[model samples]
Every structure is written in structure tokens, then in C-alpha cells.
Target: MTLAIERPVGVFGRKDLPDDWAHEQVTYFQDPETGLRAIVAIHDTTLGPALGGTRFYPYEDESVALTDVLRLSQGMTYKSAVAGLPLGGGKAVILGDPATMKTQALLEAYGRFVQTLGGRYITAGDVGTNSDDLDVIGRVTEHVVGRNVAAGGSGDSAPMTALGVFQAMRAGARAVWGVPSLAGRTVGVEGVGKVGYQLIDLLIADGASVVAGDVNSSALERVVHDFRGVRTTGSIIDLDVDIYAPCAMGAILTGGAVVDIRAKLICGAANNQLAHPAVERQLADRGITWVPDYVANGGGIIQVAGERESAAMDQVRARVEKIFDTTVEVLDTAKREGMLAGAAADTVAEARISSSRARRTSPCTR
Candidate 1:
């Protein structure tokens, strides 16, 4: 029982939060043999159902994990609402390096914890988790999404996320450069993982030259082999390109990276892109158009919340296209009102949340 788990309750003032937030269900799992710890945080269910992803990382403290789950869950709520999906927000964190600590027993333990929610929170892949990990979680709870293709799930959330990012990039490009196509534009992509690799492929397909970087040598090699106009680098942030796509972990655009970025548009599937609120303003001052992370990377959740798996591809593409429209609208409004892009997106999402809450509580609806 660390103070981090108790901190959210204190800040939200148990009585002031939504009924579901008061409970703030969190399940912890510890494997005696492997000495591994994991926690799942379910935030609210005011919308329809709780949906989020399981991320594995080596967090320095329990508080970090707690804060991540809380913020990510809340972001999911805003993301779902803005994306026009009928889902709530939740997140699971495994406190270890996935490369070494992930085991079948550990995944099963995590799955059982998800089961404790009794279908309230659905789990998917994030950060260190992948379709293979989702398959393991699927063993315990059917509430898992992004499973392997053979398992009847959309194993490729990266492409859908990349699609959304590309769409947002196009909107930003149109607004700033007044270009209808990404052709002849140089885009730098960070973290050539599943999502980044797929995004690079899409960008190259659309006639955009790509410069990418990742710690994974194999992924970088694959990028080199697949596309001819691709360049690989050691550092992600230093690449001088038109658009900087951060498909890796969150908070990469911090104090230094923001200053070093040569891109005109900042958009990617990475959640919580800004290390601090001031960074958004920094981006704005630099004339770097930013597509809010939650609004831009919401296609994965939209695809999962739907009922039919067969039509998930079409729905994801459509939602990604919608993300472009939303980004353009938000950017335009932000420019007109002298506000930041993140603030504009937040305003739109918060309005939706407030309206949805009112509708849910209305006497006629009740």
C-alpha cells in the first residue's frame, strides 16, 4: 500500500468524483516465484465500458505506475468521447522490463487481475505489450482486444494508429504548408516499432521520404530493406525532417527535444507526448503544429469498442480520417482563439464529457 495508490483518492476528494471514481478499483498482482509486481487501475464507467491497454515497463516507483494508470485512464475517457466511441477508460501497468520479466505465469496473473473487474475493464496492448501478450491475457479474460490474427482479433493496431497519425499530419500540413499531399515532404519517425514501422511503410507508400530511428536494430534493418527512400539514424529527435512522428514512449518531447525538433508538424500514436504542459506552448511558439496525442491516437480504442471484428478495418480507417478533420477543426479554433492545440482539443473533449454526463443524469434518459 504505497502512498501513490492513495494519492488519487485524496486529490479527487472521494465524494466529489463520479460514483465510479470513488471506488477507483485497482488490483495488484505479485508473483512469489519471479518477484514481479503489476497493477491495473479502472477509472470510470460513465460512458459505456472501460477500455484500455496493458503496458509493461520498469517503473522507478509504485507512484509512477499509479500516476500513469490514472492519467492514461482519464485520457482514454477523453479519447473515446472525442473519437465518438462508447467506451470508458482503464489501464494496467506491469512493473518490470518486458523483455526479461514477461512470462506465461506473469501474463496469467495479470489476466486474472483483469478478470477481477468482471468485464468492466477491457485490456489491449500498449508500450511493451503486443499482440502476443494480448493472446495470453485473452486466455483469462475475453475482454482483451488486439489479439493475433488467428485468434480473431485485429493484430495490427499500429497501422491503424499510424493511419490516424498520418491523417493528422495531413491536416497539419494542409493548414501550415497548404499541401494536399505528403509527397516530396520529409518525415522523421521515432521508435520504429510495430506502429512506427507500419507508419513508415504508409508514408513511403504515399510518396513521403522517411527518416527513422529506433534502438531495435532488427526493426531498423527491416525498414532499410523494405523501402528505398528510407534513412536510419541512431537518435530519433535529431533527424531534420518536416514532420516528427513519435511512435515510441510518452514524454519524448521534453525541454531539449522541443528545441531541437526541425519538423513543422508534431503528431504520432504515442500517448502523453508532452512531458509538461509548458511544452505545448513551446511547440506553439515554435510554429510547430501539434495534433494532441489522445485525439490523434484514438483509432485503436475505436476499433476495439466496436462489435464486429470483420468490419474493424473499415471502422478504424474511417475513424482515422475523422481524426484528421478533428485536428484541422481544433487547430483552426485554437488559431482563431489564440489558444494552444492541446487546450483546444481538451475543450472539445471536456464539453463532450459534460454533455454526456448531463444526458446520463437527465430524468427523461434515466
Candidate 2:
């Protein structure tokens, strides 16, 4: 099989790096034998070691992969900070289609690449990767989380992530409608994959009128079969619903799209929901309560971090539930300070990160 591999060569100074190269470190690994090309980016480690999932995808080229990893890694740092977790942000991206190119040797080779970083970066599961993939990566590296529960790791993070988003939705309801309940509300969910399916379950249980859609027909079918009364729509964003939850890919809420959003609230498990910073202001001007994506979907990282700390399941759930309070805080701050929700979230998260850095550098009071 011929692989469209592009090995990034030459030394890149800070000036030569991409515009989004605000990361602490960015390393590329290529194993010609196993046809494995990966990029691991560490954005920060002020609180502790960088922890994030490894995304495996078939990108068009190296530039796209770099951009994705940079954005995702930075988002993780903010996610952990807002969630009050003691983790920094990092991410890994494998440059190939998992379906056609994944193999034991390739995963193991990637694991070895992770091992070279020592304990500075921890690997988990993201899109196109799962607990089983973590299991394979764990074979060659100790710095892996979100492995199967049977394998003594945190297992899948999707359920926890969905739970966090659900809580965020509840908080959104409180902020906008003055009620902390989803009952009698109509929520439009985009993407019924791992996290979205479980979120639909929670919404259904809470008596919310659910209108869901997914690009994957099988995923849509599973939700339709499992949940009665869940209406499926071809266009979730355009649906006349109280809340629009984006659980699939990122940047769905672009400038043009925000103008047409009928939903009063936007809360979802997807990262980087706003394509540009300007979109945050647009949502605010439209009077839509937008839960910052990282703050809303941080439960998965909290779960994996708990597993790393050897915390119990109850502990993890409690931490995940705190997303509700965080959501409330971010919204309240945004309203009070006359700032956009995304800006408010960044303020809150950056405060925590900045405090950590201060404590680390300050001389000890002996």
C-alpha cells in the first residue's frame, strides 16, 4: 500500500513556525517502516504535565495536521484550567486514516515516540481513537490514560464528556430561562457519535424534547431506535429549538452561521465552536447564551486526570458535575463584565494558569 507521507524536514525557528505556534514544544515523528507520521504539541505545563488525547485522522497534508494539533492542544490547556484540573495542555495527531492505515506496529511505534517525551505528555483517546487504541499505545509507553476499564484505566471518556455538556446545558437554561432544568425544552443535537449519543440519553431522561441529527446514518439510526420521540432533522442548526448542541466537529458556529442561529442557547461537546474570535461577539449581540466549548466539555479530561490520580469513580463524577458551577460562573462573569462568554471563560481559565505560574516561580516563604 502506498501512503501519502510528507516528512517535515529542516529546523524551524520560532519565527519560521506557523502563526499558531504558541506552543511550548512541537515535535514530529515519522516511522517509515510502519508508515506512521505524527505530530505532538505541548501548549503549556504551568500547572503540571501536559495531558490530552491523540487524534488519528487522514489529513490532506502536514499543514492541516499542524493547525489542528495546535488549536486542540491550546484548547485542552484552557479546558483543564477552567475545570480546575492540575493538568497542562498537549495533543498528538497521527497523519493517516485509522481505518486503512492503523496497525499494531504503527500504534506501538507511536507509543515509543510518546515514551521519548518521558512523562511530560500523557496520551488518551480523541476522534478516530478510543480506549482500545490507548491500550495499544500503553504497551510501549506508561504515559497513557483512558484505556479500557478492564485494563485498569479510565476507559472511554465520551460518557463523562456528554455528562459535562448536559450539565452545561442545564446551566445555560438557568442563565437564559431562569430555570436550572431541561424539562419541556427542545434541544437540537448535531452529531450523534460517542458523546452525542449519551448526551441524547441524558436529554431524553430529563424530559427534554430532542431533535437530533448526524452525518453518520448508523449513528442517527441508533439514537432513533433507542430513544422514542427523538425527532431527526437534516439541518440541526436551522432547527427551531431552545438549545443547539454541537457534538461533532469544531468551528460550526462561524460568523455567517451565527446570524441564522434560532437556538437561544449554544452548549455542546465540540471544541473551538466559534470559527473566529469575532463570532463570540456576534452570539452575544444576538442574545444567545453561548457556553464556551472548553469549559462545557471538560469532563473527559477531568475523568482521565482522576484516573491518573487513582481517584474513585465517585470522585470523578463529582468533579465532572462541577462543570455546572463553572458554566454558571462563566456566564455570570460574562454578563456582569459586559464581555463575551468566550472572553469571560478565557479570563477565568487564564487566571488559574497565571496563579499557578506565580506560585511556581515565587520564592518559598521559609
Candidate 3:
């Protein structure tokens, strides 16, 4: 759905998503004192309240942030539903460079704005934000998750995200190679940050040879130091590996990148991996097995979702492990229907949400 927001003088430009979009709710806020200009989009709440993370990042314009948050929130809606979480999708994006603009006061200001939503949108750590930042947000509002363990919340969902992706990679291997193992497989990881590093750890532990790269030299250096003998040829994106894990930003699979991909499987933690619908067709035409990003990288939301029900970590982790089965099923459905795996996964989540909506009517009306 298309949404237009009137911007105040000197604020970021009018809010707009990259593509034509429709959403349940889109709210805009600006706090000049804290440099907090934000957009929160609630894609759906048919199953439950809109739950997702707050991503802090630098954007060239407000429209860019709007587009990112809208897509991300919608993905969270599908991610939660596919993962069997009793929650809907929503996301908030703060427009600023987190590296330079982050402060306790700013986080608290953002939390206060979130409090205005009255828990319809749950905020967590994403991109440039973390649990430490969530703790600050939590201090101001009760509608925050992924807080520090000292505060009685699950901390650092990157490991769980990685675990789920690792399981998803196994499912991809099964779909493409007729085996559920990454051992002896050469995988190229394009981004060795929080989730990427943890995924690298899992690959190493599982006896897979990993070739990792990152924009951050320090992060790449750490991966090289931690996992010795790992290859880093020219660009990580150009590696001719069996599996390509894009544990970074999205849109790598679109345009010429789709033609350049030499991997048999594409799976990673990046959101919005497919730049457009036709890109999915491109990957399918090339005989690549792609695990939907939302389906494969849903462990973080599963962890934070457990907090709402006061579930234990073991139970949460077990729930996260179910991604393996979901990934395999989505791939199977895609193959049978001749559709993209992402579309198949979205159908599963949409069906669940639709069923819930259908059940909402009163018996008296019927």
C-alpha cells in the first residue's frame, strides 16, 4: 500500500517505500534533540500484536529508511508466522548513523516514542543496534525485547540466528545435493559480523571449509585469525563456492549479481535478499536452491518471542531448531508448485494468518 507522510520543515523528505506498498499501520516520528527520525510499519496483526526489531542505520534519505522498514516489518510478519510464533510483523527504523548518533538519551527518546504505540510494536536489536541498546530502550518502555541477561531477557540472538541458518544450509544441501551435510562443502560467507561470525563458527565446527569476507577489515581479520586457512580470494561475493551465505545487507541477488552467483544454494541471515520477483525466477532458472531469508533466519525473533511468554532458553532454542524442517518443506513446496521458495514460504505464513482471520468472525454472524 502506498503511504504518504507530510514532513516538517528541515526534517527528512516525505516517507515512501521503494516499491508500491500497502500496510496496516505506518507511523512517523521525529525528535530533533535526540536526532531520532523514525518510521514504524505494522504489516499485519491478524495473529497477534506486531512484533519486530528496531533497526538503526544511516540512510541517504527518509524514503530509503521508509522503504527498508516497510519491507523488513512485512518480512517479520511472515517470519514469525512461518516460525509458528503467535505474533504479527512490524519494524521500526531510526534514521541516523548509529556509530555517531547513539547515546542513552537518544535510545530513551526512541523508547518513549515506542511507548506511545502501547505495545503494538515490539522493538529489539537489529543492524546497528544491539541488546545493550535494547536495555536502554527497555529502561524507558516495557515494549522492548532482547535485553541483557542481567535484566532477565535473552541476550545476543546472533548465535541463534546463525544456528538456524546453519540448519537451513543443511536443508539447502539436502535439496541440491541429496544430502543434509555441509562437511567438505566450500561455502563463501559475505559478511562476518555478529551473525556471520557465529555462522562461520558453526561451519568450522561442522567440518566445512569457509571462505569469508566482510567490509570491516577488523571483522574479517578476526574470522581469519579464529578460523585459520579459510580462503578470502578477490571479493567474497565472487567466490565460486558450493554455498553462498550472504550474512550482510540485502539486494545482492538482484541484477547482475544473480548472474554472477556460482553457488548451488543461497541461504543467509540478510533480509530482503531477492531484489525483486524476477530475481527469484533467475535463480530458479539457474538451478540454484534458495532458502527464503525470512524462513531461514527466523531464530532471532523466535528467541525474543519466547520472552513474551516467559519461556526458557532451552525451549526457545528447540523452537528455533524447527527452521530446518520448515526450510526443507518450503523448498519442496516451491519445487512442486514451480514458484520461488520465498513465495512458497510466504504462502505458508499467509495461510496461517488468513486462517486466523477467518476464525475471528463470531459464530452468531455465521
TM-scores for all candidates? Answer: 0.89, 0.94, 0.93
CA RMSD (A), model 3: 3.7
Off by over 4 Å in 1: 1-23, 33-36, 307-312
Error of 3 at 314 (Å): 1.1
What is the TM-score (0 to 1) of candidate 1? 0.89
In TM-score terms, candidate 3 sits at: 0.93
- Residue-level lDDT tens digits of model 3 in 295-358: 8899999999998888999998898888999999999998899777877987999899888888
| Candidate 3 residue runs with Cα over 4 Å from true position | 1-21, 362-366
> In candidate 2, what residue range of length 10 has the lowest lDDT sum?
1-10
Better of 1 and 2 by lDDT: 2
**Candidate order, TM-score descending:** 2, 3, 1
Q: Rank the candidates by lDDT, best first.
A: 2, 3, 1
**Candidate 1 local Cα displacement, residue 217, angstroms:** 2.5
Per-residue accuracy of model 2 over 87-149 as CA lDDT, tens digit each: 999999999999999998999999999999988999999999999988999999999999998
Off by over 4 Å in 2: 1-21
lDDT, candidate 3, residue 209? 93
